[model samples]
Target: MTPAFPDPHPTTSTIAEVAICEVGPRDGLQVEDQIIATEDKITFIERLANAGLDTVEATSFVSPKWVPQLADSAEVFAGVRHLKRVHLPVLVPNERGLDRALAAGVESIAVFVSATESFARNNLNTGWQEALAAAERVTSVAQTSGLHVRGYVSMCFGDPWEGRVPIDDVLSVARRLFAAGCSEVSLGDTIGVASAGHVRELLGRFTAEERTRLALHAHDTYGQALANVLAGLDSGIRIFDSAAGGLGGCPFAGSATGNLATEDLVWMLEGMGIRTGVELPSLVEASSWMADLLGRASPSSVVRALSA
Candidate 1:
């Protein structure tokens, strides 16, 4: 179905092809205090695949001791690997993480590095350079094994520890990821401090060619995620990362809220007459089901309003 959102206005502006990467199972479950059952994870993944998601982050390959919530990564992947036309990407932080993912027969991997030195150390226990190197090595190994790699630059907008992240810092991290052979680099507003103006300003710096390799990962902490997304869309950004039922927060950053919900994103896109290739009702149904499983109210306004 064609989206109601008008096509981009022709004023020397071009809209980049947009793609939504679903991170419900991995990012969403990681922050939940309750451990989601393996079967439930598989079910959630399958529902998302059925809802027409092209890419879904199935789980993280971090050590079970570190992230007990996703300890069933292999089980979830093993259960849902048969789903057709859906790509399951796993998060791998290091060699061990990559090895775990490889053992699970994962063909796509995501590695992340923080834009700020402090955030890098806080999240990965390494500084920016070290974290970048680690991510590069992880991508290298995965590429050698014929796996697709996605790079993540977290805390791209602002940092809790550091006041304002410079544009140069963001670009440097992004360039490193791209040069390291990542298919794309997802820019994360980890703290949710970014505004629409910031989104436009940051995105405006990259050329059309450079922008083609970018994705916006916004959060709704300050209730500005939708605005930020619009700014990104206007700037020709097409790829976004959202969580189902608005599940997920940085465990390391207490001030951050959950991610922008998939239901809300689809609602806005469909309302604007833009096609997301996602079934809104089915996704909303799946969101409701997952929220019930998590035993928490969803942060997605569309889910709440529609379900009501």
Candidate 2:
């Protein structure tokens, strides 16, 4: 049954507003086999901003040899730096990546840390403890430069090789990020095995005040992203990370259906009287445009339904 879409004037509430961080350009395109053009990537980001997503992750400043898709991070940032209404943050993987972001006039940067040893070695090329230390270094240096820093803790729910992950392990990494001066810590369900109860249990360990500084970066690998998001909302989380058109997965992680779709997230949030400040029709259009450019239909249920 297709639920009735929200009215033109949806219900409003003071405490029900949510912020969607669109990650199509950065997290979405980074792992794709198809290398989207620099101009198209810029336009895609601009279209997302026009759709009313105030925060769009532009691109990562990783080495071109490592992530060729976003090799032109500086050019991409230059293209959309004029959008005053939107906040575009680039991912800085290390000190070199941070240097590139600083040169690109980036105002905000995100540093990633791994929660599992396997993922840490694969993604950040170090042990989990060392990866945490590296993240701290990047966070401290980025802070010194007066740039806002957001930290990501990946593999929080489960690991492919290690099976289930412990809550204590995830908590330690998250608290390390907070202590290292990160303004917000995004808990990533990298392989997306998180259930609603698991989401509640994980978040319940944090104080209500701590929840305020947290965001959920969910994946639909197990079709639980939306449910997990609802659970997070119930626990007082305000920020959510998603990609437009459901377009990305980690190249290091062996999962295909990763990244929750921005359209889907906006649809659920707006319909439930939680304002996401995005135009669903416009967002769907943007994702469809990118899907066409990529020569594949979007995997997003909302995008598929609306684009149908």
Candidate 3:
């Protein structure tokens, strides 16, 4: 499927390629009521790779007590680790999670910290300061071991409990993460409340050098994820995080909805003549397969429209 709009900004030719990180197997399935079998999860990752996604978030190496759906992270990693040229990144919340991920032979890992104190406490059971400290520690260790680390700053725009997050607070966490040796820091609109203006304003705060090491992870709760992505694109961001079939929501965040769907993002990008290295038809097929596994229609409009 193609986008409905014409090239509104034809002269804006700064970015050549956009890298998408697919987070369906981890963030998407974490909140699912049914636990996906480890073998099936491996198949999903392979299918995503087959659809031209070079980077896929395989699973989270957190406690089973917290996310029972991804309890077989080790098996999932082992199963998909042999896929040539596909970078599989797993989420590591703490030192223990990092240890588990490292043992599973993961080449890349991501650590998360909330920009607001309320979400920090609610999600990680720690203050924002403590969360940063933990992220710093994990990032340091992971980088020293020759592993690539991606840092996430959640609630960068607005938090459910804490209304508007300050720009300074978000930058502080991002700077600390980069200082701690994270190759890139992904800014997350966790509750999907950010508008294009908010996105441009926030990206405006970062220097051009800092923008190179940044990525956008926008949720679509308010139907603003794609708009926010365009804002980021105008601001020089080349990387974005998305879930297949729009299959993610925060289990801890009550108001959180699905992450931006990869299929929809690719459609918009392709329509803009932007190169995403993803095949839209194959991606929609993968989303449909996942929707069947979850026993529900995909939340992605592109998937529904193309399938129809």
Candidate 4:
């Protein structure tokens, strides 16, 4: 049984499935003014996993002084044990952060890097080079411990301080992260300014093999996240990052807004006949519960429509 197209891009031909990494507990919660209680955060992750999200980023191991919203990272990790079916990856800022993650017995970890100098200074409190060095060091050490590492390159499309980010700048950081041992690198449209054209151009720079290792983290501020996701699918990208209920943005990047909603992404993927393995009804209910906890309506359009 030979097929017409040996390989089908997720966009045009039928691709089997898309990996949706739910970031509601980590990237989503990090920016909130309302501190979701630690138990609630644990419950949130459990609910997301139970609803069939394969991967859920649990929390970041950074100084609580800087991100007070996730001050209970260790406690949250401790209270909730990892599930056999879920891939729970925690963000570690550096070797020090990595130490905390190791002690918490995490199976996978993620390191984030800024694609611009201004964002490096503001978000990481260090120059881009220095912060990248730390990330590399952390990645190496984590790999040594037999843990999977995912690298995050933020502000890849545009930065609040630097305007449109040069693709070369993103390439420099992305290559370094891969060289340092990241199994996958997620490109972030941090300020939500990137459109389909820009996304295609940036992804075009990679070879087929490199493209296989890439993921898209498109925020929805300009309402182009799903369009960018389609572009990524056209480019053969399989992984996409989203937060439930469109929960959070980068606290350091003020122009940044809610990430692409998991519900929205799920609905779109399933509609496109790309299996996400997520039940929309249960996902919506979970997001609604979290929204109630946060004392607000969900920012996700799909959630709003479905709940209504």
Question: Which ten residues in a row are the worst by lDDT in model 3?
Answer: 3-12
What range of 10 consecutive residues in model 2 has the weakest lDDT sum?
1-10
RMSD of each: 3.7, 2.6, 2.8, 5.7
- Cα shift from native, residue 224, model 4 (Å): 0.4
Candidate 3 residue 278 Cα shift, in angstroms, is 0.6
Instruction: Report how far off residue 59 is in candidate 1 (Å).
Output: 0.4
lDDT score, candidate 4, position 261? 97
Encode model 4's per-residue lDDT on 237-280: one tens digit a residue. 99999999998888998888899999889878876778899977
lDDT order of candidates, best first?
Answer: 3, 4, 2, 1
Residue 297 lDDT in model 4? 96
Q: What is the C-alpha lDDT of each candidate?
A: 0.88, 0.90, 0.91, 0.90
What is the lDDT for 230 in model 2? 88
State the lDDT of candidate 1 residue by residue for 1-308, as single tens digits.
22233333323323423589999899888998998899989999999989988899999988888789988888888998898689899999899989988888998999989999998888888888999999999999999999999999999999999978999889888989999999999999998999999999988888898788899998899999999999999887889999988989898888888999998898777666667788877788888898998787788998887777
lDDT of 4 at 89: 92
On the 0 to 100 scale, the lDDT of residue 98 in model 3 is: 93
Better of 3 and 4 by lDDT: 3
In angstroms, the error of model 3 at 178 is 0.7
TM-score of the candidate numbered 2?
0.96
Our model 2 lands, by Cα RMSD against the true structure, at 2.6
Provide the TM-score for each candidate, comma-separated. 0.94, 0.96, 0.95, 0.95
